[model samples]
Target: MIISWWKETKSIKEVFVVFCRVVALLLILIFALVGLVELFVYLGIAQDGFIIQRD
Candidate 1:
């Protein structure tokens, strides 16, 4: 009974680790995309002149 419990606990831990890794990867991807978009905007690659007149 103890051995079975230990195995079950280990399996749960492994699954939790995998889930954390997947979440980390997704966050990294999201940040990278945001950075790229910001870079483009900074370099004027995204701005097509739509004048916002002074209010």
Candidate 2:
């Protein structure tokens, strides 16, 4: 859960800065994870490889 302390913060500029920082970090982390997964698949390291298994 996100901290609600930002709601009590009194400055718009400060809140916007914090919000931007948080969003940027989230996007960077998500991209890094997706990049890693794609790298693994490209290297054929994932179990079952590119062939989808049927139920």
Candidate 3:
């Protein structure tokens, strides 16, 4: 992966494949973080209205 960043790609497809993988991983991380935060709020372990308001 480090080599990809420095090395030239033979085709645009290679660049896009790497780019898509990185994007997918980032999205997964973001959604995981959001899910964990929501779980915390649901459990009352987190402060209400600080992260989200409870009704």
- Highest TM-score scorer: 3
Misplaced by over 4 Å in model 2 are 1-9, 47-55
lDDT of 3 by residue, 1-55 (tens): 5536656665778877878888999999989887888888779988665455668
- Candidate 2 vs. true structure, TM-score: 0.67
Note each model's CA RMSD in angstroms. Answer: 9.1, 5.0, 3.4
Clashing pairs in 1: none
Give the range where candidate 1 is weakest over 10 consecutive residues by summed lDDT: 46-55
lDDT of 3: 0.76
Backbone clash numbers for all candidates listed: 0, 0, 0
Per-residue lDDT over 1-55 for candidate 2, one digit per residue giving the tens place of the 0 to 100 score: 1423645655667677778888999999989877776777778897533344435
lDDT against the true structure, each candidate: 0.65, 0.69, 0.76
Question: Comparing candidate 1 with candidate 3, which one achieves the higher TM-score?
Answer: 3
Q: What's the best-to-worst order under lDDT? A: 3, 2, 1
Which candidate's lDDT is highest? Answer: 3
